[model samples]
Target: MTKPITILVVEDEMIIGAKISLLLTKLGYEVTGIVPKGEEAILYIQQNAPDIVLLDIHLRGQMDGIDTAREILKEGHKTVLIYLTANTDEETFNRAKQTRPFAFLSKPIQPQELQRTIELTVERILVQREVNLQEDKPLPQETNEELMLLQDRIFVSSKNKLVKIFINDILYLVAERSYCQIFTKDQQFILSVPLKSVEHKLQTAQFLRVHRSYLVNIKAIDEISQNYVFINKKAIPMVETAKEELFKRLNKV
Candidate 1:
């Protein structure tokens, strides 16, 4: 079974903490524990190392949420920190900003907001995992298994299973050594094949080779500059020749 994302809730109010834990559980996350103090939160994190820490900025102890976050980073723990704040002054906001938290949730958290925040955080975690894998290990050449492409969608391996990704949903692709990372509107997939291989299989006029390492969908282009094309607000490098070709394809006055 897939291991669910684990979280540690650090809220001083027992009732609020319990409510948050229950909500998290219902959202399919594993709540490791709920601690009411920064000191206990730190101690629990030192051993548990949950994937995320939901910290309330105001606490009874000497260490506040920002202080706890600093200590966690100081201890070399790279966990996503989400701050919960009922009220914030300039000084507290500055201090919290210094910790570089993933997000901030106001008190009386709405279920939809919490769910959206966690979902975005999970996507970030997945992307970071792919980057770490690329840095830590050498990517092998094309695997024996090939990506299954259909008229409108493609299937790629993810978590030991084939996940369907519609062709129209693709934003762009980035080549890293022998691996290609396929990007869609909300998710990303890494395929053990070269960029050229995937491009050939795509076989569509909508997808253009914007750069040596990038293949972008024409419909997803938000802006085009001299040296880059923006897709979903992400700047992708573009070569001069490819830029000329892209301009030729677009209708301009």
Candidate 2:
């Protein structure tokens, strides 16, 4: 069975702290600590690492909640810290956002918003776990084509290092000299391998050869116009020869 997401609540007011704790408990989370000040909250985090920390911006102690959150983040804890603030002004939100909390809930929290945020946070954690699993898995040469379909991951040699790549995150591949340049949603990597060898390994129907140098993920193409395919604002060359096949595959969708 999966353990409930343990949480620490740091709010100065006793009534608000208790109310927030009660709400989280009702939503199936375990409230590990309910402290009225930032100092105690930091101490609790030092002793025990919770899955998420719900921190109030204003606290009655040596440290303010924003500073406390930054300190906690610097300690290398993967805890999802969220901000609970009454200030909704653009400047206040901008300042709070600089810390990049998982979520920022307004004062007098709405149950619907709180529930949605918790759900999103948990789902994100699950996705990270899957990525970690892929990273930990061993690399094997003479690839198994079926592995990409089953695991959505690949281990490739890049600059003499084993690099783990989540295949679903990859949007396209471009062939460079003795290498394949992989482009994902957030980053790009170059792995040393022949383009043909990669195409052989990733022969799944999801990836199509739109051009001699480009293998594009069919699902990632956003639009097509005049031999140019748009993928999330990035233009990918679409040859007239491949356009017929591209339309054929897209029409089947």
* lDDT at 96, model 1: 93
Q: Which stretches of candidate 2 lie over 4 Å from their true place?
A: 1-3, 139-253
Tens digit per residue, CA lDDT, model 2, 225-247 = 76567676666666688999888
lDDT of 2: 0.74
lDDT, candidate 1, equals 0.85
Write one digit per residue (lDDT tens) for candidate 1, span 1-253.
Answer: 5346789999999999999999989998889999999999999999998989999998888998888999999999978999999899999999998998877889998886688678657755665567676658654433337899999999887766779999999999987567788999899888877889999999877889987878999999999876678889676768799998898878641
- State how far residue 140 of model 2 sits from its true place (Å): 4.7
Model 1: weakest 10-residue lDDT segment is: 135-144
TM-scores for every predicted model:
0.61, 0.55
- Clash-forming residue pairs, model 2: none
**Quick one: best TM-score, which candidate?**
1
